[model samples]
Target: MKVLVTGAAGFIGSHVSLYLLERGDEVVGLDNLNDYYDVNLKLDRLKRVEQHKNSYNFSFVKVSVEDKEAMENLFEEHKFDKVVHLAAQAGVRYSLENPHAYIDANIVGFMNILEGCRHNQVKHLVYASSSSVYGANESMPFSVHDNVDHPVSLYAASKKANELMAHTYSHLFNLPTTGLRFFTVYGPWGRPDMALFLFTKAILEDKPIKVFNYGNHKRDFTYIDDIVEGIIRTLDHTAEANPEWSGKDPDPGTSKAPWRVYNIGNQSPVQLMEYIETLEDSLGKKAEKELLPLQMGDVPDTYADVEALVKDVDYRPQTTIQTGIGNFVDWYKDYFKVK
Candidate 1:
């Protein structure tokens, strides 16, 4: 199958692209290579994909999803069989500082993707949502069936809006849209803005790492490989309308239209302190911690209920935090030449 992957140079995008290529799928990668964190890191990730197996099956283009003309042209030219829309302005705390970026990237960019998929007659549209959408809900394990109308952060709001927009398209055009609400994704080649990367960097440099929510926050840190596996399974299994769905008692996860949402996570929430300790063990260095209150637009905890995902797609998260962190530390040390 021929697939289009937005945010191809990003952390998850890069891995997803490689995974598709490895599975003998033709992939057209797209990314603006924005300096949200480090453009060099993005470039290196792309290089790694290009150097790996099935490199000939992968092609890349530089473009932003918000650019309507560019997106339209690409869609018309490529006519992708499916699309994995992972491109978005990501970061809960950063959304509070620069809200417009979220609007342009997450909102407008997603509009362009939906339009492209709708016109191109794409078979499946698997896009990334967020665990943040379950904002202010103290549910033990965040489930797709739960109402997510109350998102505390603009980032979360933008994701929720994407799900709504996707449902509209699925209803109107009979498009098959599947939204995966990802929990805290981490592993090798992760975003510098993410907790694992930040903590690792700070710890390596003997700097103090800020422990948010006074180290009380719990996160279901899903590994990158597990996430890619779930993504591939979802991409292959196109969404179908739930015949049991009724407007009288509509389910938030499934619709009468060909739209669905699922939580893609490890299904095990670990405390912030425990996560850092795992990292410390991986790096053989102790972190200097500065306990701090939770930042605006941040949730205290996120635990994903991936039962639907497992039942539907046979998705399973196999990596533990210790193993994931150890893999990350090895990659980090090798990539940065850390002794």
Candidate 2:
């Protein structure tokens, strides 16, 4: 299998590329190497992929998904058998600050990916969505079958739009598409903007970590390996039109076309304070507490009901915060040589 994995230099993308390459697949990894976070960290992640097992099978390209001409050319040149679209302008609160960035990278960039997949004879397209789409629903254990019409943040709105756009392509062009709504993914080599990374960094530096929602928020914090597993599983199981789907009672998760959406998350939701405590335990340090109100454009809780994913993929995310955060702390200390 020859796979094109966009955002290959990113945390999840790097891990996914390495996984595919290890399984004897030829992988073409693509990323713009933007400075949204640390470009050095992104470069280091790419190096890890290049040095890992079956590294020869991996080839990386410098490109952004929003660049239509470059994306089209790459698709035509590679003739990719499948695509894993992971590149996006992430960060819920960041979306509030810079809405235009979200529009460019999440919306326009996704459009370019869809066009590339459609024009090429790609077999299946698996892209990342977000748990934030369950915005304003106040529903416990967010389910894909439920309605997601309300999005509090522009980032969430972009994700919902991606689903609608994918459904259209699946229906009109017969393109098999699957969207995975990932929960709070965290692990070693995680993004700097994410909570795990920030908290760890602040704690090591003996700084006060801002506890949002007064440490009342709960999240289905899925591990990075679990997310890669879900991606591979869904990629192998090509999307197919649900025969029993009815227009009278439309299921938002499935369609008459070859389009489906699933939630990829740990079913176990952990409170923010518990998560912080786990991190403190892992790092052997305590964080100065600064309890803050729930930041705007953020959900109070996120719990993924991955029933559809389990039914289809026969897999579930099972990493506990203790092990996950411990692994991250070890990596952080080793990566930075922090005593």
Q: Candidate 2, overall lDDT?
A: 0.94
Query: So what's the TM-score on candidate 1?
Result: 0.99
Per-residue accuracy of model 2 over 58-138 as CA lDDT, tens digit each: 899998899999999999999999999999998999888889999999999999999999999999999999999999988
Estimate every model's Cα lDDT from 0 to 1.
0.94, 0.94
lDDT of residue 64 for candidate 1: 93
What is candidate 1's lDDT per residue for 1-339, written digit by digit as tens? Answer: 999999999999999999999889999999999988999999999998898789999999999999999999999999999999999999998988999999999999999999999999999999999999999998778989999999999999999999999999999999999998998999999999998999998999999999989999999999999999999999999999999999999899999999999898999999999999999999998999999998888888899889999899988686899999999999999999999
User: Which regions of candidate 2 deviate over 4 angstroms?
Assistant: none
Estimated TM-score for each candidate: 0.99, 0.99
How many clashing pairs does model 1 include?
A: 0
Clashing pairs in model 2, backbone N/Cα/C closer than 3 A: none
